[model samples]
Target: METVQSQSKNSSTDHHDHGGIFGEKTELYFAIISGFFFFLGLILSKLTPLPEWTSHSCYIAAYFFGGYYTLLEAIVKTRKGEFEIDFLMIAAAIGAAYIDSWAEGALLLFLFSLGHALEHHALNKATKSIEALGELSPKTALVRKGSTTEVVAVEDLKIDDIIIVKPNSQISADGVVIKGSSSVDQSSITGESIPIDKTAIAPNTKLPKFEEIDSSNVVYTGTLNGDNIIEVKVLKLSKDTTISRLVKMVSEVETKKSPTQLQTKKFEKWFVPAVIIMVVALSFAHLVIEETVRESLYRAISVLVASSPCALAISTPSAVLSAIARAAKKGVLIKGGRALEDLGSLRVIAFDKTGTLTEGKPRLTNIIPINGFDKNEFLEMVLDVESLSNHPLARAISKDINSEYGIENKHRSSDIQAIQGKGIRARYNGGNVFIGNVEMMKDAKITVGSEIHQQMDELLQYGNTVMLVGYNETLIGLISVMDVPRKLASQTLARLKKIGIKQMIMLTGDHQRVGDSIAKQIGLTDAKGNLLPEDKVKAIEELQKNNTKVAMVGDGVNDAPAMAISTVGIAMGAAGSDVALETADVALMSDKIQSLPFVIGLSRESRRIIKQNLWISMGVVALLVPATIFGFANIGVAVAIHEGSTLVVVLNALRLLRYDLKE
Candidate 1:
C-alpha cells in the first residue's frame, strides 16, 4: 500500500501547480503596458504638433492596447450569454467612439483596464497566505536506502522510506522519528511561535496510542528542523500531509461565494439589461424632443458610461477574501466566504465541554482508601490495570501514580475488559478487580457504605468525575478525576460578550453538577449536562429555531453532528486531526481560545466593509445616472466617476488585510 507520505508529496505538487496560476506579475505587466500607451496617446493628441489623423490613430492604438484582453473576455462571456463589467465597459467605449469622441473612449478603456489589473493585484495579495503555505515544502529530501543516504525528489520518496532531515531544512513529508531528536518550529501549521522539542522513542517501548498521533514523535511536511539531524520513517505521502490539506482548504474557500456576493450577482442579472434599455430609451426620447442627433447620442452614451456596476461587482469578494487571508495568518482557517459571513451574524455560540473550554487533560484529584487497604498499594494496583486501558481518565490516573508514588505497570493482569461508558474490569492475582463509575460498582454487587458515598458526593459536587475501585466484590477505594477549564476560558467568554455575543452555552456528557461548575467558572450564559451526542444536536437545533444564528465549537469528533447542524462549525486545535480539519467550517490551528474573539472581530469588520462598499458603489451610480439624463454630467465626467468608484471599493476591501485584534 502507498503510504500517506507519498500521497502528501504528490498532492503538495498538485496544489503548488494550482497556486502558480495566480501570480501578480502577469497583471502588473498588462497594467504597465497599458499605462505606457495611454501616456503616449495623450502626448500626441495635446502636446505634439501631430496631424489630426495621426493623433486619432494614436488614440485608436491606445484603446486597442489598453482593452484588447478585456474585449476578448467580453466576447467570450457574451457567447456564453452572460453579461459582466467587461462587456459594459466595452459597449460604453464603442458608444463614445461612434459619437466622434475617440479620445474620451480611449481614456475610458485605459482607466477600466487599469482597474481590472489593480483588482487582480489586490486579490493576489489577499490570498497570499495560501500561496505562502504551498511554498513551505522543500522540493527534495535526503532519503536513506539501506545505510546509504541519497538526495531524491520529495515525490519519489514512498511510505516506510527513511529520510534524514538536516538542521534548518524543511521536513519533506509527514513521518515518525525513529532516530535522533530536534526542536522543530511548527508555526506554519499550528501558528505557535515557540519551537517544540521532539525526541525519538526507544525501539522497545510501545508508544501511547490515541486518536491522533502525539506531536512529539511526529514530524510533518513543511515544518523547519532545528540543529539536530533526525531520521524519520515516512507515514504520510506529500499530498496527504497536514500542510497540503490546509493549503487545499484555503484554496477551495475562495470559490464559495458569501450571501452578499450572491445578492449582488442576482441584482446584476437584470441591472445590466436595465441600463442598456435606459440608454436606448433616453436617446429615442431626445430625438422625439427635436434635439440634434449628435447631442442626443452623447447623452445616451454618458448614461451608459455612468451606470456600469464595476464597484458593486467587486465589493463582497474583495472584502471576504481579504478577511479570510487575514484569519489564516493568525492560524484560523475559515473554510469559505459563507462561513465568514455567517460568523458575523452569530448571536449564540455553543461550545463542547471537553477540549473546547476545558483543557481535555484529566488529572487525578482525590483518592479515598477503604477497608484499611494500603493507600500506596491500592494506587499501584489501579495503575497496573489502567495501564492496559486507553481512556483519558485511565491515562491521567496512571500518570499520577507513576509521578507521585513511583508505581509502574509490572503486574500481568489477564481477562482485561472495557465496559462502555462505565469503566474497566480485569483479573489480577486471581481476584476480580473493577475500576469504574458508580454504576459499575453496583453491577459488580459491591456495596458502598455511607462514608464512601459521602466522599463520592463531595467530589461530584465539586465537578469531579468519581470512579469506584472494588476487589472481589468488596469496595476498596474511591478515585476522582477532574478536567479543568482552560486558562483562557474566562477571558474568552468575557471578550465574546464584549463583542456582542448574546449567549454562550456549553454542552457536555458529564454530570449536571460538573457541567454547571465549569460553566459558572467560565461565565457561560447556560450549561446543559449529561447530553448524548444526539442531545447536543437537538440543543443546537433549539437555538437555531429561536432565530438565533449559532456557531458550534468543539474538538470535531463527538461534536461533529452538533457542529454540522449549526450555522458554522468551528474545530479547536485542529492541526493534528484531518477529520476535524475537513469537517469543521472553521478550524482554529492552535489551542488558544482567545482566537475565537479575534475571528469574530474580523467577521464583523468584514461585514461592515461590505456594506460600505455596496452603498458607495450603488450611491455613485444612482446619482450619476440622473445627472447624465439631465445633461449635468458629460461622458468624460461619467467615466471618471465610474472608474473612481471602482477604485474606492477595492481600496476599502484591502483595508481588511491589515485588520488586527488590537483594534
Candidate 2:
C-alpha cells in the first residue's frame, strides 16, 4: 500500500488512513535509501563477483531502512493489544523472509517504501492548494513612517500603520486605500474573474452597516496591486486579516470527520483484524491439506498484501480534501466534509431575498416634492433628518441627496431621534422634519395630500418602499427606494433549476408584494413574505416533512436558526458579517451569486468520485483475494495491482483541482 510511510504513528493526521501521506520529505528520502540498498543487493548477487555475505549484508541493510518505522509502529501497537495495517504489511514481509525468500521479502519492502515516497510527493501537491493560499501574502510590507518608508515583516505590521503597495506587488494587509488608485486581482480573495478598480475614499467616510470591508476602497491581504501605486492604512493586525481567518477555519475543518470517513474508520477497526485472522486461517489450513509450508505461507502473505484496503481508506478523504482545497483556492470556503456532502443532495433551496437574492443595498429611485415646496430645499431637509440615522433607506436617501442633488450643508437638524419600526424625526430649519414611512407621518399627525397620497400608493404597488418627507406638520415630499435584484440572480436560479434542484423559493421579511415582485423578476417558483427568523425555520421544516432536503441561503446571522435546521447553510460573502463567515456551513467568499451552481456541481462531482474510487478499490480486492488464494497471483502481482489501485484513487481525487464551473 502507498501508506507504508503514514503507518508510522508520528507522520499522519489520521493513522487509519490506511494509505495516505502528508507529503513529508524525510520519509521519502529514507524510502529512497531503502530502495538503493535493495537494488545493490540484487546487483551484487546477480551480476557482481561479490561474496554471498556481502549480498546478504546489502539485503539486511535494505530491510532495516525500509522496515524501521513500520517495525517500531507494529511493536508499539502489539504492546497496546491493537492491530494496524502497518503490522499486517510487516507480517507479510517477515513471513516471506521466513520462507527462505529474503530477496522476495527485500523486494517487497523496497517497493512498499518507494510507493510511499511517490504517494507522499503526489498527495503533497494535492494538499498544497490550501497551503499556497497562506503563502500568497508577501513576507514583508513597506510601511510608511513620516516621509520615509521602511520594510517591515508582515507579522509585525500593526493596525493604523500606513503601508505603500507598489505596482505589481501583493498587498500585505487588509486596509482602506487612503491615497492613489489602481485595479486589483481580487480573484484569490473575492473570486472576481476581472480585476476590480479600487479608488481611494475619504479617510473618514462612514460605511454602510454590515459591510466588513469596502469592496471598492479597501484592499485585502494577498490581492495583487495593479500598475499604479496605492497607499493603504491597515485596518487590522496581521493575524486578524481575512486570509489568516480562512487559514484558521481550514485548520479547524480538517479535524471534522465526514459521515463516510467515520464509517471508513469503523470499517478499518474490524477489517484489519479480520484480514489478520483470515491470513492465519489460510496459513494453518494448508498443513491439513498437505501443502508445503513455503508455498502456503507465500500465498497467505500475498493475500495480506492484496487486501490492505489502502485505496478504500483514501477514497473519500483524498477527494474530499482536494475538493475543499480547490474551493478555498477559488474563494469559496466549505467548512468541512459534512457541508460538502450536504451540498450534493439538496432537494429544495430557499434564498433570503434581501441580501442573498437581491442587492441588499437600496437606491433612491423617485424623489417628489409636494405642494409647491422648493424641491432642493425639501431634499436638504430630508437629508438632514435621514443622515442622522443609519437605516438602509436613510442611507439610500443620503447617498442620492449628496450625489444627485449636490446640496451644500445648509439645512441643519437638532434633537434627531430614530423611532423603531417607523422612521426618523428631527428639528430642521425652525421646524420638525420627518423621514420615514406612512406610519411615521401618521404618528407625527401629518397627512399626505391627495395627489401625494395617490403617488405613494402607486409606488407601493410597484414594490417600492416609500419614505414620506414631512416638514412643519405638512407633507412635503416622497422618496421611493427599491433594492435591485442581483444581476446574476435570474441566471443563478435557472442554473440551479437546470442542475435538478426540485424547488427554489424566496424567503423574505419584506412585504409580500415586494417579495413576490423580486421573485417574479428572478423567475423563482414561490415567495414567502414577512418571514421572521423562526418563520423561515418553520418553512424549511415543512419542506423537510415532504421528504425533501432543504438548503437555506441567507445573510447568515438572522437566518442562523433556519440555516441550522436546513440540510445546508450557505452564507453570502457580501454580508461581510463575521458571524456569517465563521458560522455558515459554506461561505461564498467571492460574494458572486453565479458561484452557487459551481458549489453544488463540485460537491456532487466529488461525491461521485469518492464512490468511483471505492468501487475501483473494492473491485481490485474482490479479484485479487480470490486469485491469490487460487495460486494465480504471487506477491509481486498482488503488490502491483494493490498499490496501482491506491495510486489511481489518489490521482482520481487530484483531478478535482482542475475542475472549473462552466459558464
lDDT of 2 by residue, 622-655 (tens): 9999899888987767767766887899899999
Off by over 4 Å in 2: 1-274, 372-377, 388-393, 404-408, 412-432, 439-446, 449-464, 482-484, 508-514, 529-535, 574-583
lDDT per residue for candidate 1 within 1-663, as digits (tens), equals 011111112222222223323353444455456667767777887898978787777677767766765676567667878775667778887887787667667766775565444434433321454555566678899999887889998878898798999988899988888898777865444432235567775686564432155667887787888767899988878887766765565455433444444554666577767887888888886547878777887788888867754565456666777898899999898865567878989889998877778876677888888899999878878988998875556778899889977877777677888765467899988899999888888999999888878888877887887889999989999888788888999998998998899999988766678788889888999999867456777899899885679998977334655665678888886422344444567889877778999998999999899889879987988999999999888876776776688789889999999998763
Candidate 2, which ten residues in sequence have the lowest lDDT sum?
1-10
Model 1 misplacement above 4 A: 1-266, 283-286, 289-298, 369-381, 388-392, 403-434, 437-447, 461-463, 470-476, 508-514, 529-538, 557-565, 573-580
Residue 564, model 2: lDDT of 56
RMSD, one per candidate, in order: 12.6, 12.6
| Model 2 local distance difference test score | 0.73
**TM-score on alpha carbons, each prediction:** 0.59, 0.61
Clashing pairs in 2: none
